[model samples]
Target chain A: MSEPPQEQPRPEAEIDTPPRGLPQPEPAAQPPVPAADSGAAPGPGAGAAPVWGAGPPAPPTPQRRRASTVHVLQVIALVVGLVGTGWISSEHFRTVWLGSERDEPVAVDGAGAATHEGLTVSLVEATDLGATPSLPGTDWQPPSGFHAWRVVLDAESTNPDLFACDVALVDGGGRHFVANLFVDSFVDGFEWTFSCGVPEPDDDVPAQQALLVLVPADAEPTAVEITSTGFSSGYIELEID
Target chain B: MRRRWMIVGLAALAVVLGIATNVADARLLPYGPTSSTGAIGEDAGAYPFTVHVSQAQAAHTVLVCCRFETPPPTGTDGVWVVVTLSYATADRPRGASGTGLVLRSADGREFPVSNRTGSGGWLAGPDIWVRGDLAFEVAPDALEGLTLVFDPGIQLYGPMPTQYARIPLDLDPGAVLDVIELSEEQILGAGER
Candidate 1:
């Protein structure tokens, strides 16, 4: 209203005029941040103020998309970490639990007999004729009446050389006696078994005495000994059945 | 929105953890496969005997002997003795078999002895051990004696005799004899339990 209407100002003339110490406006819109300003705090001479005539403001669509992509990457990282931890734990457990199954036999010296389900028995005996008479405690008593007595004798020779053993059963009366003496196979030494049945003496016999003795006729007891060194030097199981 | 997502994640994780723990437990827990039964074995050269004691069984002692020869090693040639007892009360003096019992050796072997003859002695079969089930009949009362002798086998070592003397007296009711000498003291002590 203050200016004359005859000379009308052109609408595009003001846009073309360059302002002092400022850039001309671009037709396309541009974001406020510069390449140098990326990831930096705004400063007095750097990213603080927007360029005077850079362009119209841009929409926030691209930035929102980038934020959503970052969220997806975080979820992927969490899943990978969990899987790695589980795999390591499983490997560790497998190494710790295991067992062995097998049967092993143990060997022992002196009367070695092992039984798994049922018993397996063996017997051995040795004697020296010279040592027989030297034994201590010479006492014996015979059972009364017509009694039946059975005795089994087994012997093995330890030395590579052959040997023989003689077993004698002397009745309560020094006059009557029974004897079983035999020579065994010498190839693998000697393993012999002798069994005898003795008849019972009369009940009226006065304080009868019985003595059983073993004598090595051909070899000494030192040459042939039982598997168990712990033996009585000579002991026998006496069963009255 | 963040809080809501966190709550949903936590709930899903809890369900997954519950399933994993339960699944592992179910897969790992079950009984093992080995079910063992009793089978007893006897010593190879073991001799069997039966004894009967009566008032007439006075004065002279009865003796049954088994001699063992020495093998190269003592353990190779050895013997073991096992016994069983059966009785009849004043009402019934004749005993029954099978009900008597079974005994075993150091190793697991079944030695079955029948109480067939109430007044006679019953020798054990070839086996040397008592089965776990029939062990009751061999309860200390059944034992008479155990003897072991080492003999010379193919290779002559020497003769050694091992004997354990045992007896069954008129055992007093409600009385027990702690057989301290049966084995080592520690082993007998543990058995007290």
Candidate 2:
């Protein structure tokens, strides 16, 4: 109870109180800080204690006080925004560059069926046309040292939005090739439409397409994956029979 | 005193911002397309093709080339602006693929070639002249100061072309016709390189 106001510490670094040299209250009128007199640690730098009669430290004016608070809020928001942006950028790198497949892809057997968005794609059959694959009506043949792999798929979607699809093949060694890389837009009478068939406004029959791909004869392709932009999750990997 | 200076600074900032906005609206941005301007009845180099626009006409109904007899012409919401041009490639063989012609109006609006009317093209070799009719459906009010941006060497699935020819057409708004008969595109063989 006998500790002088000059010996009491100031509350916070940012609270701007009057200079310590200013006139203070009488020793008897000055309230003692319990912690200071009770042999406990005083408030941070409480050694400079606020001037006796002067209340708590504040900005010079009410407007300045508001401005100070706004500055503190702005700093907090800027730090939070920077942290959020960094987190998103790291996640993007992981998904695109590092090839961290966020979730396991939805996989089906060689001839199984799977639904994505509103479209259900079914792999009917896959055939390996070795070296030289010639259709009955056309004379188109694979180039030298190339093997033709044919894929027949049935795409059916009741929705008229007409979702487009991409068909790709992944070899046993993990080499990926898009459908059109080796095959023409049309092959063996059936058109390799990148789009799932246009189900008539009233008809329910699915559109069937026969796609062909030419790969190096030595390469062993293991799976054909079908993906649509409509699906945000991973693509569907259908094993090659 | 500081308040007066602050007001002056704000006014200056507003003036600078207004000027910047006007410049951006005038298509002066660095990312905007660079144009190769050409006038009607002039030899305009639209990428690989040197296009010579002979005439520009307006029609209410247009019988597009090839299959006009099967589908026939019908009433359209906008007038068809047909530009009859003779083009020849000077460089290597280039395929005139996809929708490459666009009509830029006086008010900065652009109308691409009507793809629904089946606009597609074949290959033209070095020095081979091709006679074709490029038609764009546009509102009658945009006829004034209409400029055609033709990029004949556009790719079907790749990065966009860098530059295109801007041909200004001298159109007659009062000359709206019933139907314009558009014939098939003729690939006139080489002579002028």
Candidate 3:
């Protein structure tokens, strides 16, 4: 009844193209139905809804727009806000409880020396500074009920890069004391050298590194320890006479 | 269903974040030195040092603390409270925080040493008790149940509590005098102790 369909007459593969010599059909794939011809039917599947080119091919969807500068900036800000706050909070908690502090140290007797990172520290002598010892005109002095003592150390090294160390006196009671840094001046060669003989660049460490410390009257210090403040925990414990 | 789930997820996230913030502020945020409280004449021990508050006094005219009279009659109406204390450290307090003394009253009023001459913040090595005086200016009525607080001056990175010596001071407001001389910080030598 629908005048034998034009494309249906052709083979399946050749439906897309007809011979050029053949008379040309209307421009569109299917002719539009007139409003007056309401009784006319479309393709086989066409009933309440008539789909165009539903069997052979479908129309291409419109391309989507690209992301905008504002959208990208919003994403970046969100990531930064979340990551920054999380990192700070976690970092604060992480630093609170350090797992360990001291490590097994290398022990050396009197007249012996220890070295780390190319720098060497040695104990030369231990002298007793009697009760009532005072470095007059200096900001530092021995407190009451304590005896002052001097631990002489000699240091030698050619390297000063990232160099920091602490030399402390240990009493028989396990008390530790380092040379006081607040001493304004060196009175009468009474030096409390906390440097542990760290020499200046290209210069020799002073011959005698006098480390003065105050020990309690009950127990006198029998040894001294040297440690680097950096990551490496390797240390030296030198005995005193 | 999906929309309801999204709302529930967002609400859960909000509650979690609220709890996290509260916990962080209460335990994590504060770091550095620790502190504590004590009474006069008693030995209080803290990290890096041990302290004892020996004496406390109040005066209007303080001797050897920058000026002869703390507050000139023309100046603010306040009284001078001087504290004498000593502390010993087995460890070096190098570059540590809180060397000066602070005066805290019963009602939570705090006053620090104002005058620079012979002021607070003296430290020494182990076995040696470093004796010093710290003077503060406070209202005449604020002298009741005064306490001297000393922060052991530890500025460590962790949440290590700073050792604080809060030794209560007893003074008679009526006993306020016109002149008082402050003692110099002295390292107790043999007989000097």
Q: Worst ten-residue run, lDDT, model 2 chain B?
A: B154-163
A60-89 in candidate 2: lDDT tens per residue?
898888988998998999899999988875
Candidate 3 lDDT, A134-221, residue by residue in tens: 6565555555556667778777765555354677778765667665443333665556444543466675446666766666666667
Model 2 has an lDDT value of 0.66
Q: All candidates' TM-scores?
A: 0.18, 0.36, 0.57
TM-score of chain B of 3: 0.68
Instruction: Give a tens-digit lDDT track for model 3, residues B90-177.
Output: 5443321344467888899888776543454765655556677777889888898887776655545454345566677888888887
> What lDDT tens digits, residue by residue, belong to model 2 across residues B18-88?
98876764465332433567777777766556777778888998886674355678457988988776775
Of candidates 3 and 2, the better by DockQ: 3
Decreasing lDDT order of the candidates? 2, 3, 1
> Every model's DockQ, to 2 decimals?
0.01, 0.03, 0.28
Off by over 4 Å in 2: A1-241, B1-34, B65-71, B152-161, B189-193
- Would you give me the overall lDDT of model 3? 0.64
- Of the true interface contacts, what fraction does each candidate have? 0.00, 0.00, 0.50
lDDT of 1 at B23: 63
Cα lDDT tens digits for candidate 1, B20-110: 7666544532311111121112212211211111101111111222136322211101121222221111110121233223343334343
Q: Rate the local accuracy (lDDT) of all candidates.
A: 0.28, 0.66, 0.64
**Highest-lDDT candidate:** 2
